[model samples]
Target: MRIGVPKEIKIHESRVGLTPATVRELIANGHQVMVQENAGLPIDLGNDKYREAGAQIVDTPEEIFAQADLIVKVKEPQKSEIPLLREGQVIFTYLHLAPDPIQAKGLLNSGCIAIAYETVTDKSGGLPLLAPMSEVAGRMSIQAGAHALELNQGGRGILLGGVSGVPPAQVVVIGGGVVGTNAARIAMGMEAHVTLLEKSIPRLQQLDSLYGSRLNTIFSTTDALEEYVTTADLIIGSVLIPGGAAPKLVNREMVSRMKRGSVLVDVAIDQGGCFETSKPTTLADPIFTVDEVVHYCVSNMPGAVARTSTFALNNATLPFVLALANKGYRRALTDDQYFRDGLNVYRGHLTHAAVARDLGITHTDALNALI
Candidate 1:
């Protein structure tokens, strides 16, 4: 099988689909890895590194998509790349389709096999491919929020960890999944007053046991979120629903109530955002003010730290990539139920129920479709 690693085309997306090490692994498993020229530049992995690892470097994306049977990417394919997709080709990437009607429809028409990273599940209902980036995004949410709190950054100018006689800033994190937990951990480490709202009691208990006194864990309710968010200096939106669109936990009304100079970072922006006022922002101009509340909704939060993000993402995705290349997507999914769940679109049909429901389209069960 020929595996293609195209340079990510999404704006501000520096993470490459395959690292040099991943290329070497695939080559060792009797698969050819084709990497586009300068694909790993932003991640600090040069083309020479890939060549040394036995990956053939191609000059054009057209060459890669033309020859490679499996096309892997870090983000969803942009409009330009959509034309390069061919029928029966396997595209493995983080396709956040719920909010992207256009991309979803495009894939449906392409007759390509689309396996979404965010939809792949583990035995415990964990998203394998999305975890590393989620971790990076969660940790960075605090870092960015902390930086955004300065008066110059359109924030309250209050220090997150105050000096003696000065109280720390209050940070409210909605959702208690990977992003929320990591955000709370970072906030707690900074000595900020951190409150986490999660709908799951089991997850909350897990968080409570993990950070008994370090953080405040609360059962998330719309009323409670509205009541407390307005008083916060930093509000982190970290809600997720697998392949489904994110629920808007913070509305414009909620933002209007927030104090001037307060910052809201929506980590769930990739899934259509958890904040009503949230719109995808780029790193160049990563913020906007609505209702006097600073909003930071960079869709690819992990991309900000390219080297770290790329390596971490490779760690999680490499194994699956290897499986797809070695066993072929069908055999790989047939062998592992976890990988099977990754199948969003297969053989020209939308196999993921959530995706079908979102677009009001039809779908068959992935297992049945694969068979």
Candidate 2:
């Protein structure tokens, strides 16, 4: 199998799909790996490192996309790259299709087999490939929100961890999943008044056991959301629905009623967003004001910490990458139901149900598409 790693082209995105160590492992297993020139250079994983690991350094993304059987990438294929896709070629990356109709249409028209890293599952029902980035984004949400809360950043000029006589900022996290948990943990650690809302009673109970009195865990509801959202100084939107679009828990009306200078960090922006006013922002220009409330919705939050994020992502994705290279996508996907969940598009057919439903497109089961 010939595998290709292209330099991520998204604005402010610097993570490479494969690390040098992982490339070496693939080469040792008899797979040929082609890396775009300087794909990992910005992160200090230079071309020489890949060359020493037995990878062929290509000069352009065209060479890689044209020749490689499997194209590995960090972010979704951009509009320009979409035209390079060929029938039956495999594209493995984070394809957030629910919110982006343009990308979805491009993939459907390309006739390529697309697997989304964010939707891949583990036996524990956890998104193994998405976890590391989610963890990074979750932690960074607090950091970004804190920075955005300053008066210069179009925020309320409130400090998250206030001084002796001043009260700390009120932090609200919507969801109790990986992103939400990490966000809440960091907020609490900063001495902010943290409140977490979760729809699952079992999950809420679990969080309660974990944090006890240190955190406030509330049942997620319309009233609960409105109550907390209105008073929150920093509202972190961490809700997710797997391959589906994130539910808009914070409506425009709710956002309009928020206190002036309140900050919203939507970690769920990749899957649309939990906040109604949220729009994907780049790291270069990460925040926008909506109804006087600051919205920090950088879609690729983990990309801001590219080096750590790349290594962490490579650690989780390498095993699955090996499986696909070794047995081919069909066998690798068919053999593992959890892995099959990653197949969002198969030769132009939408293979993931949640993505299909959310996009209002025809759906095909991954196994059926494999046939």
Alpha carbon lDDT of each predicted model: 0.91, 0.95
Location of the lowest summed lDDT over 10 successive residues in candidate 2: 362-371
Best by lDDT: 2
lDDT tens readout by residue for model 2, 251-310:
999999999999999999999998889999999999999999999999999999999999
Using TM-score as the measure, which candidate wins?
2
lDDT of candidate model 1 versus the reference: 0.91
TM-score of 2: 0.99
Q: Please state every model's RMSD to the true fold in angstroms.
A: 1.0, 0.8
- Give the Å error, residue 314, model 1: 1.3
Clashes of each: 0, 0
